[model samples]
Target: MNTREFKDMDLSAYFIGPKGENADIFKELTEKLINEHIGYRQNFNAEDANSISEFEKTTPEFTNAVTNMKETLNELSRKMRSGSIPWTTAGRYLAHMDNETLMPAILAYNYAILWNGNGVAWAGSPVSTLMEEEVGQDLAHLNGYNENGWGYVATDGTIANISALWMTRNVASIPFAVKAVCPELVSDKSDWELQNLSIKECLDLLDKTGDKKNEVKAQSARSGKNLQKLGKWLVPSTMHYSWQKALDITGIGEDNLVVLPVDEHYRVDTKKLEEIIQENADNHIPILGVVAVVGSTEEGAVDHVDKFVEIRDKFREQGVDFAIHVDAAYGGYGRTVYLDENNNFIPYKDLKDTFKEYDIFTENNQFLKEDVYNAYKAIGNTDSCTIDPHKVGYIPYNAGGLAIADTRMKDTLTYYAPYAFQEGVAVPASIGQFTLEGSKATGSAAAVWTVDRMIPLNISGYGRLIARTLFAARKFHDFFNGQKFEVNGKTIISYTVYDPDYNMIDWVYKEEGNNSLKSMNDLTQAFSAYTSSAKGGNLYNLDIITSDSNFSPATYGDAPVKFIESLGISGDEYYKEDKLQILRASTMSPWVYDEKSFNYWAPRIKKAIQGKLELISTNENIL
Candidate 1:
């Protein structure tokens, strides 16, 4: 390693058990959990109660339960060990799901599950409620939120996304409702006035209209006018399927979803987004909201969030008002770029060393560009943001979160259950009154809190882990893109690794005199798609473990044709069966950055491609 380059990686913190004491930690957590359970049970005298343990001493049911549990546990262990998907930490395969997690998080989660704490309200689980609140505050701060901001954990990214949209939908409709019943409240108001009313103002207007909160909710449930008839939701083509579902659930029909085309880099085209917004306005359709993705699902592209903010502000200056929601489910925590050792945001000048440390500025200047930097920095200004701790946080599954820039956004959606919120407890202290989920797991909150405590959400912690993953991606890209094979000193095949926005690498074979495969249409007709085995036990059979992305006509609706044309290639004919299957590799595994591990795996990746090409060249009916 060159001394001139930056070096600040604390390699020990990268693993689950840095000191190799996983066994001791697991044992300690297990014992503590049992003791806590016993302590709770001891509240009622043992002599007065015939508990399960006592009954089990005399009955066969306890034995039966243990027997069944042991058998199931054994099978679970067997299946997990034999699975094709690489386990976390080994770092061979990466198509989502990182292989490393903090030991504290796991231990804390195990301890919490013993109590089965339901984070519905204070009365239900007081400890978990506090932990959940801390977790929310931590996430809010991590994702660029401030004192005025608020956030909560949900089941996953989809739920978090829908929850944000739900709030946006209801909040946006309040002004129109107020105007309809109490005309005086909005008679002389401008467009921004009608659209940008605070939740309290809208609620006060509803009260002035002689309507109860429940009555307003009831009317909304019964339906007044569909959101599609009201406005359009502008989204990019690279959007996750969750947005489509969000529309349906929010009563905004999917047809009203204005799909913006992606640029060559796969980021949303701001020019087209502006055009569509203006076009919709001219047609008397309001722009309901604009969703900017911080990490696109397929290509990991980060949209220019600052550009979205600028566009919104430009429209706002002209009396147009709309909300911007950033879906950062996959890349929310990547904002670690802004934080320093003390978790304070540093200026761009200071970020250069961080970039240099990961070697990110070498080829992909996109990551360090001003627009990209501002995009991440602008997260604090968005109306709402959806982030999943499971994806990049290395937390256990099913931990998605939604953060609102203003806590007032939650007021309109509040619902209090008579039994849930006990006496003497305030609404703000408990979350059941506002969240979409009712009976949520407190264990998830514990896991996030414990892990984040150990690995603070700063340059020295979460930032370090994420930097390694990104470095692995850069490394994999270099290796995959540099491959040109020869058998017996004769060049047989080469590859064209499609440029990715992040860690996802898509590559296609480049064959000599393959002019017939000039376009995706021609290639699909010639080569049959590769299919994986159904049973799954084999992972390393192919020197490289990769999946395929088939850009066929049926799947993309002519987008593939346009994409191929943009590549300076020609395919005169168009066929529904026209498919362009590209091999994909995701370097989400941080372990790949380890030189020894990467050196061992790099040649295998090449061998996999070379072996496939050799077979194709020699066989007659290989397709």
Candidate 2:
């Protein structure tokens, strides 16, 4: 589509369905449901009690509560006015929140809320329980796990991550438990030696433990034992805060969580990962597992999953292997790039043109980049994954997912409460038995299921939406790095974008000067003048996220700090503060798909950058 015409494209078409047919059908279905189920519960034969409204009138306390609620809502409405993040304003956003959702999801959630269904079990929410099962299947297929695999929804990425790690810790210990109890199955092998054993070997050893096969089938319950035999976990430095909680809750002590170094792109260093595994092995610490972040919380960096698997395979050859869990809470759905409507792999050549057409064409595009593409493609190869539909899937709040490549992994972590799920029962049938949390919201599952039905979890669906968001991010990156301001044919200010990994810079700002805190702070102030609500203006008010780049000599040492200093970028100062602030933009708005809309938004952002630099150069306090 041409830029101007693209601007006019009806994005809601994706939400509402053909000719608004589904929207009308949905409305009609909801009305019918209300008429049958909730259209006045009182029968004509029964005398009516006092209505809730009448009670409010007669009871002062109830009336006061109502008044307080109204007052609070009024205050909230007033505060909401100052909020400037517009979902429709092209791709000028730098926030991780996309603020995009579909009509079906909203409608489905509304439909389910009236019932207030809990998905913990079939008895509580019959329809929603089945819906959740369907949703799990949909999510699994997206990550290349078929019906043979197993997954379910959780409250958020935190719970999903914890669940995945909890499973890993338990599964890692099964071999050790068997070795201690039944030495013949794994002759002379210590628990540490058994940790690296292949899955087949682990299962054989489990059989020898004489803990009835039924226990493995339905024993996700926590033993509360500090099974030190599970050993330590390896994770990239860019890990989410939830990992620590996973370690704490799983009884894997904080000291056992070994954080590894990340490469220039903020991805886990594969070489370093191997080194850590070897070092742990040398020390006789049975390695629990390695974590590969599919989409890091900050910077949205993707780790080398493909390389992780390759290294793991090599380790397997040496009788040294460990579970690999992918924390793709943010980026798992980005796997849409690799699949088509039928969940079949699309040829790279075919995808290249579509990527180019979307203006996301770049060497850094994961689908185009061999290593990155393989990383995404290898998601299903991992033991388990955390995928949040609430973030990229555009579903309503509190819907995260955990998918297991091998359904057998669930055998170790299964927990059965007599009151919740009976012992010896399989999950989904007894879904609550397998999860960390009980009493889950079935409405969340309905929302995901309803949306996936309308928006297929494949290339022509969510993939296209994601591609637009990515294009927007790349566009902003290019504009900030490349644009130069000119007045009356005289050269003026320019800005630099920090993309040390891709090296995607114009050097216009670099030639003028290097990046400094003063420059960055000035830029922030000027940008705020245009985009901040207090300024009575709006365009693209960028937000900055800072990270602790500086570390103690033991944690990170002087080498990284020295490297930044070598670039003439004041690394010495940042080293002391333990900060590396970067301007991040999340072009997650689908509206940015239109070139015309993005073009309109892009220029103003450039103007803001140029204007900031000019103001700073003229006066130190002008900002």
User: How do the residues 1-623 of candidate 1 rate in per-residue lDDT, one tens digit apiece?
Assistant: 32321135444443554234456656766688788787887775766755456666667877888889999999999887566444453444544445556556666777787776687887778887777888888878876778767788789999988888888787777766555545676799865566655444555665665544445544432245434434678877778889999989888778878887767566888898888887866666777788999877666678999989888888777666678899999878878856875567778876776656544343343434566668888888788899888887877776888888777677667777789965346554687777889998888888888777667777666776776666666667667554666643444333433455455665555443333343332232122232132312264342334455565444344544554544444534335346656655556665565567678777765665566555544542322
Top lDDT hit: 1
Alpha-carbon error at 431 in model 1, in Å? 1.7
- Could you tally the backbone clashes for each prediction? 1, 7
lDDT digits (tens) for residues 418-505 of candidate 2: 7666765554455676788889777799899887766667765676677666666566656665455653333444343334222111
Pairs that collide in candidate 2 are: 94-585, 219-414, 220-413, 220-414, 220-415, 221-414, 221-415
Give stretches of model 2 more than 4 Å off. Answer: 1-11, 14-37, 40-75, 82-88, 180-183, 199-211, 214-221, 224-226, 353-367, 424-428, 485-511, 514-577, 608-623
For model 2, the local distance difference test gives 0.65
Model 2: weakest 10-residue lDDT segment is 500-509
Off by over 4 Å in 1: 1-14, 17-65, 190-229, 354-367, 422-428, 487-498, 516-543, 552-579, 594-597, 611-623
Residue 470 local lDDT, model 2: 65
Q: Report residue 126 deviation for candidate 1 (angstroms).
A: 1.2
Estimate TM-scores for all models: 0.84, 0.81
